[model samples]
Target: MTQDAPRRPGRRQAMALGAGLLTAGALPARAIPAADVQPPRYALERGARLRVLRPAKFIDPDEAIFNENTKRFTDRTGIEVRVDYVNWPDMPVQVAVAYNTGQGADVVIGFGADPHLYADKVADMTDLAEYLGAKYGGWFDLAQVYGKKFRTNQWLGLPMGGTTSPVVYRRSWVKEAGFDRIPNDLGQFLELCRGLKRIGRPCGFALSHAPGDAPAYANWLLWSHGASLTDEEGKVTLDTPQTARALDYARAMQETMVAGTMSWNGASNNRAFVAGEIGLTQNGVSIYYSAKTSSDPAQNAVAADTEHAEMPYGAATKAPETALTLNAMVPRYTRVPNAAKEYLRFMMEAEQYDRWLTGCLGYWSQPLKSYAESAVWSSDPKLAVYKDAMDTPFYEGYRGPISAAAGAVLENWVVVDMFARVATGQQRPADSMREAQRAAQRWYRG
Candidate 1:
């Protein structure tokens, strides 16, 4: 397996890039609360200000638009909103420091699993469900996480945008390699990779042993073989035979991957693909969008030739894992909790949602089932790939009260270490997975 050179900048450099690229606009006007409602119950007064803290980098283009949209809200509602962009690497530390210093923002955005880490700091959203339900025509679909319905009252966070890991390939390159269609199984995928490699171009993947992308690749393998990290009772379950087989398949395929992939993080993977060093890869749809719109000419290699397909399958199952999702929440300590709720409500409005989705540079998948089925997406050729993929998408199991903390630990450290070991050949796939299971057990027990 090829090792990627260590080119990732320090956390401070990432933060500096975010600070430079981030642009904040004037706050928008606040929505007026109706009379007979408690003054402090549903909405902020016309000039109320809300402070929001989130990762500073623009991984998802929708965030930048969301920042601008928040200003529009302020413009309309006479509310003042301030967004603090913290780098992903520094987010945990910054959040902890802020909360410790009593300086946490009214709203905080991070991974869907983050709320569990700071559950005590987030407000229970039960009361707002009634209002959201009445406004949106029904209850929000928290059930997508697990098979059962979640109590909306206890749901402290709302999904900001949804995402899925898909196989993004170079249509031209794959076709040139004599593949008429993207492979459907691991064997065919590897065969295609080997074919591409012979021609001096290699298939690539975002298999970095880092937060966010590591578990993504792991889930791709686990779900492809019908395995899951947790069973219905919420116990760790990564040591099964199916999981082992899947890992074995991955290890074999690793030999066919592009050079330098082992060290490439999410951003680097995108960069490599856009630079035309790799012929195919699996990742979130957002990367495809960035490549298509990048100002740098060398990074737009697949701009007009890329295609999105459902993740490849394993020997046993035809279905892929559920798409990754990110959520938004209001903190319990916000002086403007009502305002924050109203902001969430505003975000879900059809017009605003469209802007948020489109602005995200195709990173976001529709959250509401009804929205996914709407004519707007069905008719758009550019978005049809995602629409088709969502037909049978799956989500993580055990998406209950522990979703936040559990997800954080799994994505941030456990999965990262697993990939690092496997990619570097320091441990066998089964051994790495067993270690990962131990890590998960320790986290769950905590």
Candidate 2:
């Protein structure tokens, strides 16, 4: 894997490349002659109507965009594709129920590590995955790990793409607090939090049962501090000094944050920021999308000043930021596996995927490395930070294979609850880590 390669950018190094390549989106695309890739195709024997179930993206705009883009697909191929957008947290459960009942979402959005959980039920896409992988440079490590099974090389879905959870903050508030730059390390981040509090614009990472943001922040901190959900053997390994250290830092950060963060869900931090209640939070660029689209002048101003930066790294330079991968899995029961594969191939094409990510406003990062050459990031400097996010994210099951066990841990909120306990003073950092270790071991044993 390129992950362990020395050439891959480390923490500060990635930031440097990030700042330098901030204009990479301005670079022109160059396509040399290469081998032909037979596009995925299907006969008219299968029904034209394809039903897809997907969770919302960056305020659920992905649904409309996918619907709009498929118009071109339908126009060209005469396939009627309908994408049904559901709540982010509810997506997995809904798909599971539908698929188990002999019904199927021709394509299901694999969030919360859904791909690994249903690998056997989903159609094998090894040929398609390899085609796209070779066609588009290579798949991101998380993409490969998430879509494929644990030990074998079986692929259950197309590694459609992932979302990078970077630190989204208000530049004006940071400058108002007397800092010209966002924090680059944990110590600086804490100080920045103190300054934001001083300026009456406290920042917070939602600690509630936020389906996305809460667990995202928890994993970011843990991985940054060199803690992980499991060891290489896929055993529970979260109760370490590194984990305690992360918890301590989170506790100190909690002291500087807004009071109501503990009760919040995924949308809370975004809403808080849009309402001008917080100065910073860890999220995709959805906050910018909301602020920019809002009719209120104040909201527009917040959008104007909003910027994205890397999550502050811990003392170790090996920190791997977390990401969410959306695998497009076609159920085994679906007769239109070829059609579903075609839809995936369509979305990953240069023109189609570029517009999709742009329409999502950088909320979704591409699994294909070549997609980085798109001009969307350079079109606006704010979206540029996320350009490197998906490129360097650690999957949910760090240092271990992606498995149902990992999904159970994540779905049960073991890590999120661990951090929430520390932040809410429900348990001492070490105590919380110990309890969480026990809780996680139960899943690991299964």
Which candidate's TM-score is highest? 2
Model 2, 17: alpha-carbon shift in Å?
Answer: 29
- lDDT, candidate 2, 352-377, per-residue tens: 66666665656677777777766666
The Cα local distance difference test for each model comes to 0.61, 0.74
Angstrom error at residue 423, model 2: 1.5
Q: Where does candidate 1 have its weakest 10-residue lDDT segment? A: 23-32
Q: At residue 89, what lDDT does model 1 achieve?
A: 56
- Name the TM-score of candidate 1: 0.81
On residues 88-121, what C-alpha lDDT tens digit does candidate 1 reach at each position? 5566777666655656787777655566566667
Backbone clash count for every predicted candidate, in the order shown? 17, 1
Model 2 global lDDT (CA atoms, 0 to 1): 0.74
What lDDT score is found at residue 20 in candidate 1?
Answer: 26
